[model samples]
Target: MGIRGKDRQIDNIEFNVNDISRSKTFYGSIFGWSFVDYGPTYIEFSDGRMTGGFTTGEPVRTGGPLVILYADDLDCTQLRLKAAGATISREVFSFPGGHRFHFIYPDGYELAVWSAS
Candidate 1:
């Protein structure tokens, strides 16, 4: 909860979503993330390691930042994301360290998932 030991590190990430409930449900199902509501307009989520927030306080905008996630099984994660109604924006591609793919959430935020396999 405290970032005192993490100087100059990325602390929190927030997403402006159209519907808080819908965002919670989608992210919860795909990543097994847990949520805590601050109010009707905002909710915080934890993926057991990192925490972020879903907020309806601002309008949803795209093309800001790229949030990349790690997955042990890239193919399976991609399948789950697609099943959860996310659109696959980029096909799986290989890079120096691993393979990755990008997906666009309903709110138009683009995120990538990568694996070492």
Candidate 2:
């Protein structure tokens, strides 16, 4: 058997903070989330179940937490998001696991839809 892909779920999340060290300490104390540093600017965290990351970067252009979702049909989902009035903030881009695009939801929060296929 082979591994299965996570689809139609909140697969990952990212947060931007001005101070990575401070954020790390706070989250660690409060939630016990463990982190692995990537560099001076990024750190990945494992909160027992879901994995997420933190970055010492400027706030996202549109603002809000970065919530990434999994989709089976990437193109169709993009079209549907557009039709539903979500603005495409960032075009589809490929990463190690798959491709994804960022959009501003109707409520003005930014979210991403990704496909592993």
Measured by TM-score, the strongest candidate is 2
lDDT of 1 by residue, 28-85 (tens): 9998999988888888899999887788876786755356676767788889889999
Q: What TM-score does structure 2 among the candidates reach?
A: 0.78
lDDT of 2 by residue, 1-117 (tens): 112466567888888888889989999999999999888888889899988888875474345568888888888889998999999999998865678899988987888888877
| Candidate 1 segments exceeding 4 Å error | 1-3, 64-117
Cα lDDT computed for each candidate against the true fold? 0.76, 0.83
Return the lDDT, model 2, position 90: 92
Instruction: Indicate the TM-score of model 1.
Output: 0.51
| Deviation (Å) of 34 in candidate 2 | 1.0
**Global local distance difference test of model 1:** 0.76
Q: What TM-score do all the candidates reach, one by one?
A: 0.51, 0.78
Which 10-residue window in model 1 sums to the lowest lDDT?
Answer: 1-10
